[model samples]
Target chain A: MIKQLILIGLLGILFGVFFVSMQDIQELYNTFGKDYIAATGFADTGSRNLVTAILLDYRLFDSLFEAGILLIAVSGVIWISKHESQEKNAQFMLDKFKTPDLFVTFSRLVYPLMLAFGFYVIINGHVSPGGGFQGGAIIATAILILYYIDADKDTNIALIVTIEKILYIAILLVASLSLVSRGELFTNFFVIDASPDTKAIYLVLLNVMIGMKVALGLWTIFTAFLKEGR
Target chain B: MNPLLTFVVILIGFYGLSTSSNIIKSVFCVTIIESGVILLFLNLGNLDGGVIPIIGDALPVGGIADPLPQALMITTIVIGSTVTALALMLCIKVFHHYGTVEWAEILSRESGK
Candidate 1:
């Protein structure tokens, strides 16, 4: 323990040294970059949110690989934890059983609002702070509420996994559409000289696909944990 | 100063990882480390008088926060959660195998076998 403590102290010293020598961070490496994004990001991606524009357009290929990583991770998790005892056919349904008065009332009031907000965030991602990942997480939280309302609520993990895989493929295909129109991937053809409405649709479509994919992926992981050793 | 604090958070995680005997505690330590790293990245990217990354009619891009770090951090957050889930799942399997969550106990048992 003493030796480990010393190692931690050394780590802290290293971090301190790095921070002390850190350069001024306000001026980015490219002085022109932030201004460029702010000026043209909307025209380029039709998304009011510059971060989303950067994510789904500027560094889109990276985003694709990022989603792929999640896909692989989810698959690995399910494979590692799978058991023969699991039902061959599982389904996802809301809680049919009743809980305490308070829990049920809470679910009834909050669940719809949560679900609607998830959609709102996703659809308005181009225009707001929320986007695919955040909105999808919110939707996943809403789904989790069902378990609290009724412990016996039937959830279909396999179905969710399948849906996630399909969505990923769709995302890849949709992203590749730009490859045909332009010589690059993930850059929308409609972006070059398209109307604002078309650009908005493109961003919304991508957001919805990503939102669904993430929500399903997260739900699968949650279900896997719940079914562990069961 | 805030950067130093974030670094301290990382050190705290390191301290926990080095001292914690249990497997689950180690997983939590890694999570703490991830959080600290995320915080540090955001701190570095935080501008003095910058607004949020969202562009509006009134809020222009001239004084907006750096979008690069925020975007990268979103990816980092999702990756971290998946990693934590996988780690916990592994911990569960390890416990099932050795009948204990303690690192030393598991190590000792392995050698005994």
Candidate 2:
């Protein structure tokens, strides 16, 4: 009886706290106002979107390092999986898991559309709501769906790895170019006077690379898990 | 609503963090809590009588809505998805190793192993 009472009391308090917190959301708007836009407008980067300015300029280093982190994680997963004992023979495992006909047909039908949409999001990230990370993740989602549905399909691990490598190299090149343009070695470059066309090109390129890398990385990781399961 | 509601979400998230025994459930709770913060941010950027930030005839000349929040939201959304995927992968690994998804049981088993 005492325990039940205490639980009830806790629940009541939790709900009360939740209710109170929800009431305070309005204050945040009052404080920030249009300052967010104003700040972005003053930034050295040429991107019109403040968020883009912040991401590609003010916080470019963080973004670069974040990509590095993903690289490390991918490398770690590959290293770990490579050493694990190969359960049942590869051929046997492959044979046991047949790709469903419906899944194969659907994937074939949808893959091109998914890829096109993903590219569109990546390219238009600068002017619109979407960006490289979001677009990349969407692409990754499509690849993941394909992987999940086609269990018996033989994946070209080497090809995936190659694509990931190329993308990483391309990103590094873009980052390097940005740094060079700013005359800062190993530093973030926010070129304020650059033409909109240049910014769009760089942003779109970055998105496409990120999309490719993320999709491949995820596919590789899933493949490792499937191997582990077998 | 108001900042108070954001706080409420945080509090609820904390409660879930403290009480939930399932790892996946706890991850979800944390996500919910993060979402509360995101909501606070979005609310912060909103202005009275503002139009959508998009260019052209849809928006009035003077009333441009805040664009920063939308961009931030996009970043947050991507980060959230990545975190969720990573957490799910971690959960799967935990399940594979311990044959259970409950936090306490997994910990006990790990200790034994």
Candidate 3:
């Protein structure tokens, strides 16, 4: 009871402080007209969605490094769980257990739809709220569902690693190309045309690449854990 | 945008972090705190009367929510989820080595060893 009271008191104090500090602040949207970026973003980056414009065009470097951070963390997990001798063989474990009929039926029905939605999100990222990271995480969920249905199925870790590496290098190359063409990294280079549609295409392509890379990276980490567990 | 609610949510997470003896629970509390932070950031972008931050000819003209904070929050959310997953993996490894997830038990065992 005392602990609960202390917790409540702490939360109340924090809430009060936040409430007082926020009282005078104005919402930016009211003061800024349309949006800070909405005025120029469509013409500048060819993305209808201002958020996507900021993410893929204006602040691409941050996301590039975000992907890098995921890569490094996955690498760390793989390294930490490298001792395979003690771990029970994942394939053997898989062979021993029978998949439930209901789960199998459900997964089979939902898998294709989930995969399609993830890809759709990636493709339409520039035009909508979904983007590479969101789409990638969704795609990873599809893989995770599959893993849940069948623990024994060998996830092609080698293939995923190869694809992830290719995508990383490709992203870097695109950034370098942007540096060469625009004299600055991650600039919206395709905005030279009268219509910004061409630039939107570039953003979409980047989204797809990032999505696929993230999907594969997450799958790798997940499968690594599964294998280590058994 | 009532920031007080966000603060309360964050404080709850912090309270869980401080009180939890289980390593896994602490990791989840970290995720909870991250979610609260994300909510607070997205709230900052909202207006009383605003349209979605999409530009098109046919759409109604009005104030649009700030896109920058929402975009940054999306990135932060992804990073936070991945970090949480990594933390869980660490907890699993710790449990494997120490044979217990409770901090008290792990510490006692370590000192005894």
DockQ leader: 1
Docking class of 2: acceptable
Q: How well is candidate 2 docked (DockQ)?
A: 0.32
For model 2, the local distance difference test gives: 0.64
* TM-score, chain B, predicted structure 2: 0.81
List runs of model 3 lying over 4 Å from the truth: A1-11, A27-30, A84-86, A91-97, A191-194, B109-113
Residues A1-230, model 1: lDDT tens digits: 68876887888788768676665544444435667787778778888899889888888888888988988889989988888675633323332344578878889889989999999999998998888988998999999887666666557777888889999999999989988887787867574888656888878888899989988888888888766633
Scored by TM-score, the top model is 1
Candidate 3 per-residue lDDT, tens place, A1-230, comes to 79878887887887777787787676422545345476677877888888888888888888888888878777776777677574456653444667788888899899889999999999999888798999999999998888767766876676777788888999878766776667777666553554787787688888988898888888888887778666
TM-score of each: 0.91, 0.73, 0.90
> What's the lDDT of the predicted structure labeled candidate 1?
0.81
- Better lDDT candidate (1, 3): 1
* Candidate 2 structure quality by residue, lDDT tens digits, A124-160: 7666656677677777767766655555556666677
Question: Sort by lDDT, best first: what order?
Answer: 1, 3, 2
Residue A188 accuracy (lDDT) in model 3: 61
Over 4 Å off in model 2, which ranges? A1-50, A76-83, A88-104, A156-166, A184-191, A228-230, B47-49, B52-73, B96-99, B106-113
lDDT for each of the candidates? 0.81, 0.64, 0.79
